[model samples]
Target chain A: MPFSFLLLVLAGLSVIAYRFGVSRARAVAPGRQAVLHSRPMYHGLYVAIWCGIPALLVAVAWVAMQPILVKGLVMGGLPDAYDALPKARLDLIWNDIRNLALGDVVRADPAPEIQAAAETFRRLYTIGNAALTVLCLIAAPLAARYAVRHVSIDLRARNRVEAAITVFLVASSLVAIFTTVGIVLSLLFESLRFFAKVPVLDFLFGLHWSPQTALRADQVGSSGSFGAVPLFSGTLLISLISMLVAVPVGLMSAIYMSEYAHRKFRAVAKPLLEVLAGIPTVVYGFFAALTVAPFIRRAGEAMGLSVASESALAAGLVMGVMIIPFVSSISDDVINAVPQAMRDGAYALGATKSETIRNVVVPAALPGIVGGVLLAVSRAIGETMIVVMAAGLSANLSFNPLDAVTTVTVQIVTLLTGDQEFDSAKTLAAFALGLVLFCVTLGLNVFALHVVRKYREQYE
Target chain B: METAILRDTMHTLSDTHAPEGEAAPMTAKIEARQTNVHYGDKHALKDVSLDIREGEVTSFIGPSGCGKSTFLRCLNRMNDTIDGCRVSGTVMMDGEDIYDPKIDVVQLRARVGMVFQKPNPFPKSIYDNIAYGPRIHGLAANKDELDEIVLTSLEKAGLLAEVKDRMEAPGTGLSGGQQQRLCIARAIAVSPEVILMDEPCSALDPIATAKIEELIDELRENFTIVIVTHSMQQAARVSQRTAFFHLGELIEVGDTEQIFTNPKHKLTQGYITGRFG
Candidate 1:
């Protein structure tokens, strides 16, 4: 039987078990004098969990073990001469047999012994699946029957069912946490491999970055210099420019929305501001490259100044526009969170509206605004697409916004995009860059949370 | 109930007669004539006419949502901050119409300050909280003058001795009663002619309440004060005259002694005797 078909049957059985459990609970307490300890719904859930969980566990375990057992039986049925062959050749033959059993085309004509092994593999797999299906079908009803018998008036079915749900919720959250840990561990191991080939200090502090290793033994002019200072500096320059544009604009708009704008205007404008955040970054990339970069170049030449066709200014300016909503939305919420009593106090002191906002409202909301700005800064540093399309790939270690520069994210994308071996230093550098970027962003998020928490404690 | 109505009419006749009959009549610092307040669709205060006497603590006593606090807010035009709150008719301060279009509310508020039910000290240092008003109104010409004003305001509010050492500490860090006093000091720093307090002791304990009442009594010598209170005893203790409000109407206004001992209005009598509120 197919795995999905067996799962469907088990699900149907659990539903029937739930109905049976409810009826049994009703029957057990037929007299008016006898009261139930838990609700009928809890009793039904308790029986359903008992029926489904054990069968699901058995199904998972069977699926996990069947492949190994069937592979072992197939190997045993092969000739004794196969055991003397090398491990690689033996693995290739096993793969051929398994493919042939699944009715796939094989690489070459198979030997008679190999053909016999394929037949055994198919028979063993079929029998194992059939046995799993039968066992699950029987086990579900038996567990459910035991649960139904325990559904007495004195049973604490609610407590038992709630405990099962708690465990399931914990397992669900663990999947997300474990996935993050798994990704970090993989990045760490790959970065370690890259570090073995290149010294950490050189990669961190070197001024030049050229991640092209020699493809041939005697290839010339392909020395891979993995200096990362230029990329870090570029990231900082772009982020700084973006913050300069985003913070004042975003904070002013937030202040207007919270303090001055009428209610109807605020209701209409806030969502429109957030629409900027929903635009795809790829669209911003094309906008930066095709429109803004050329405009900057032409405008700079008009002023008797030189500007790169792909300048950091274009990408930084566009990215700043992209991040305005992030800063504004968070700031608007925090500013609105400032108590009305505070504004009233200032107003009663005979202060004007601007005075009240400047001296009272903004100061009270400063910590939350700082946190929002920090989050925007991290987002700017990690932004890739706009910089890739507009900011040139030249690793110029300059602070001038008009000069072309590249960031770590753009560099990582360039290093790993083409056909290449994973073992090369060029490809591994991407992992190293990824690890550093992750740590930086993680640190920023932690600091931002700390600031926001301190702000909460102030008013609370 | 019939006799109470008869006495109420008789007392109203005597109230009009006594003021003209006395040799020294108290001047009305603020006069509201035919005042009505509307909050969106609800009629909050209706045709209320009253006078807040000069240099005396006048208390407004009523149940919750009776428009006593609403009337107090109107003295300083604090109702302007609320959306859709409409005030019709005249509120005259020293014979000047406060709601006139030419009147700058900032200047009006500078002359008439208010304290809220809750202690709402600004999130600033104690010294700065008091100095905030004087600084904004340009009342002080220099740092030394500002410092003197802050010190005198704190001294007048009776908080200088308790918070003298922690002058730089945050105003919000003070105790509830101390914070309320800090707010009073902040109000005094601006040197307003009148001070309106709306249930200023509601968030405080008995000891804090006693302290604030004492402060209000001392402040009456320098400022015209209007207070709203839920506690009848607080009104009797801190005010020379008390006005009773029921629903949205002013039931009666008289000397505190007369209102407590010989209330004419049935609603005022029921409220004072704890029969029904």
Candidate 2:
């Protein structure tokens, strides 16, 4: 019988439990009157919840793991000639076996050995599925009968239910925690792999960066240099410029709107500022590429200075505009959250309105403002489209905003975007960059939360 | 005392009071005549008239939203701080109309300082919190003079002994009662003639309440104080004059001893005797 049959059987068993529990409850052991306490329905439900929950989970786990376990056992039987093949080639053979088992045809070299492997794969999968279903059929009702017979007034059924729920919730929380740990561990391992192949010191300290590799054994200008210093420099320069624009403008506006602006004006202006966030980064990317870049270049040219066609200045300016809402929205919330009592106290002290805001409101709001700005900086650092479109692809290792430069995200975009050999150092470099980006952002987010939390503790 | 007590017993509420210049004249530091206040369509204050005497503690006792605080705010034109609150009355201080168009509300507020229910200390050092009032008005010539003012204010508030060592510490770092005193110190540093306290003891413990009440008595010697309180006991203990407000009307006003001992108006009696506020 399948697991569905077992569930139906348990449903039938619960009906029997219900009927028998009531009569059994009425017919207590000679002098033990408190032996049966709960209503018959509760006894039935208690047994049913126990039987169904564990059995279903077990059956699902078995169903998911059966195919992989069987496939591994079957693959172990393959000839040593097949076993000695490279892992990638073996993986391709397994893919063929998977496809054939799922009735997907493959046009690769068809040997009798390959055909036989496909057959074994399909046959074992059906056998395991049937075996697991039968196991579930016998397990659910026997478990339900035991729980039903044990159900009594003093049995603590509610306690058992609560414990089960607690376990389930803990398990769900662990899944999220494990996923985060897995991602960080993978990034750490791959970045370690990247560091092994490329010299760590040079990657951190070199001035120039150009990642290139030979297309064939004979064709190469350079083997490839993965000195990541310039990419890091470019990311920092753009993020610095972005923060320079975002922090002051965002914090001051948040202070003004939250503290000074009349209700009618705040009601109108806050949403209008938020509309800046709603416009897409791709749109800002276009604005930077088509309009702002040309304007900056012309402006620079009039001053007898050379500005790159795709200047970091244009990308940084647009990105600054892009991240303003992030800073303002969060800082605004924190400023608004500062108690009205503080402002009233200032006013009562004969402090002028401007003095009250400057000396009182802003300091109280500082940590939250810093948190908002840090989050925006992380956002600016990871920003891809505007930089990719406006900041040039050359890893120009220069500090001047007028010079064109590329960030980590833009290089990652250029590297892993099309058909390519996954084994190549060139393709894997994208993951390495991704790993680095993830670490920086994770650190920044943690620090931002820490600062904001510390600030809250100071007052309340 | 019997004749005066008899007069308090038979009084009924009237916005218009007969002139009390039988032998000489009555002197009022601040008087509101036919005062009415409205917030949008809500008539928050009915026609109410009263006087706040100088160098004495006057307390307004009423239930919430009865406009005792609103009327207190009107004395310094603090009603101008709120939007959509309309006050139609003449409030005179020292025989001058405080609501005259030429009178600056800011300058008026400087001379009529207020303390709020919750302690709202600026996120600054103890010295800065007290110096804020005088510095904005340019009361001090230099930092040394400002330091003296802060120290003097703290001493006056009785916080000097506790917080003098930590004068550079954040004002908000102090305890709740201490912060309230700091706020009081902040208000007093400017040497205002009149003080309005809006439920200043509402957010304090009984012990803190006692300390604030004592401070009020001490401060009354130099400043005319108007306190809005819910505690009848507090008003009786601290105030020289007590006014009972019910639903925005000043139902009765007299010496606190006589008013608590024998109130005339029915609503005033109801409020004082724990019947209904």
**Pick by DockQ: which candidate is best?**
1
Deviation of model 1 at B165, angstroms: 2.3
Model 2 lDDT tens row, A90-144 = 8888888778767787866667777788888878877877776666666766776
Quality class of the docking in candidate 1, CAPRI style? medium
Taking chain A by itself, what TM-score does each prediction score?
Answer: 0.95, 0.87
Compute the lDDT of residue A104 as modeled in candidate 1.
96
Q: What is the DockQ of candidate 2?
A: 0.60
The stretch of ten residues in a row with the least summed lDDT in candidate 1 chain B is B15-24
lDDT per residue as tens, model 1, A279-353: 999999999999999999999999998999999999999999999998999999899988999999989989999
Candidate 2 C-alpha lDDT tens digits along B174-195: 9889999999999999999999
Candidate 1 residue-wise lDDT, B207-252, digit = tens: 9999999999999999999999989999999999899876676778
DockQ scores of all models, one per candidate: 0.77, 0.60
Candidate 1 ranges with C-alpha deviation above 4 Å? A75-95, A104-114, B1-24
Worst 10 residues of 2 chain B by lDDT: B15-24
Considering just chain B, what TM-score does every model have?
Answer: 0.93, 0.93
Task: Point out where model 2 deviates above 4 Å.
Answer: A1-45, A76-90, A215-217, A262-265, A458-460, B1-11, B20-26
